[model samples]
Target: MARVTVEDCLEHVENRFELVMLSTKRARQLATGGKEPLVQWENDKPTVVALREIAEGLMSYEFIAEQEIVQDEPLFAAFEDESNEAV
Candidate 1:
C-alpha cells in the first residue's frame, strides 16, 4: 500500500465536510483499541486508506461556504443550535 500523507487526507476532508465529520467520529471509535484498518476509496481511486482514516480522526467543525447560505443569520443560529445538540 502507498503511504498516506496528511495533506492528501486534509484536502478530501475540506471538500467532503459531512463525510469527514462522520469518518472522524468513526476513526476515534476505532482508535481506542488495537483494531484492523478499514478500506475507503476516493472517487474510484485507490487512495491510501490510512490517510482518509486519519483525516476522519482529525475532523473539526466545518462551515460550508456557498452563495445562498453564507451570510444568513437565521441559518447560522439554526446551525449553531444543531451543533450544540450534536455535542
Candidate 2:
C-alpha cells in the first residue's frame, strides 16, 4: 500500500490500542537495529517500515507478545557493582 493506514493493520491486530503498541514495539526494534524489516526497503523511517510490515501481515500481536521487554537501564543499576563482588 502507498500509505500504511491503521485500518489496514487492524486486520492483523484486534484493537487500535494493541495495534499502536505492537507497531511502536516494532518501530523500537527497527530503531535499535535488533531486527531487519520483513518488507522491502523504500528508504522509509523505522516507524513507516514498522507500519508497512504490519499492513503486509509480516507483524502480528503474537510476535509482539512473545518478545521479552528488556529495559535499557535496569531499575536496580546502583547495586550492580556490590552484587557482583565476591560475597
Candidate 3:
C-alpha cells in the first residue's frame, strides 16, 4: 500500500488529537527500540510505521493503553530542576 496518511488513520481514531497522541507515543516507543512495529517496517520512518499500524487496525488507543508504555520524567519535574538550579 502507499504511505499511510492521517486521513487513513482517522477512520480508526475518531479524534485527531487522540490520533496524534497515539501515533506519537507509538513512534517514540519504536524509536527507542522499546517496542516492535505492529506492521511491516518497509524502511518507513518510525512515525510512518506507527501511522500505518493504526491505519491498518493493527494498533489502537485501547490496545496501547493496555500495554506498559515507557514514559519519560514528567515535564513539571524537569521545570522544577531548572528552577532550583536558577535559585
Per-prediction TM-score to the true structure, in the order listed: 0.28, 0.70, 0.72
Model 3 Cα lDDT, one tens digit per residue, 1-87: 596778889998988998999999889878985788878889788999999999998888677777765678775998899899998
Model 2 off-target regions past 4 Å?
Answer: 65-87
Clashing pairs in 3: none
The stretch of ten residues in a row with the least summed lDDT in candidate 2 is: 61-70
For model 1, where is the 10-residue window of minimal lDDT? 60-69
Between 1 and 2, whose lDDT is larger?
2
Candidate 1 local lDDT, residue 85? 95
**Reference-based lDDT, each prediction:** 0.48, 0.84, 0.85
**If the candidates were sorted by their lDDT against the true structure, best first, what order would they fall in?**
3, 2, 1
Candidate 1 lDDT over 1-87, as tens digits, reads: 455665656665555565555455444434553334555454422223434555555433331111112464765798899899999
Q: Write the per-residue lDDT of candidate 2 for residues 10-35, one digit (tens) a residue.
A: 88788899888988989998889488
| RMSD (CA, Å), each prediction | 12.6, 4.4, 4.8
Residue pair clashes in candidate 2? none
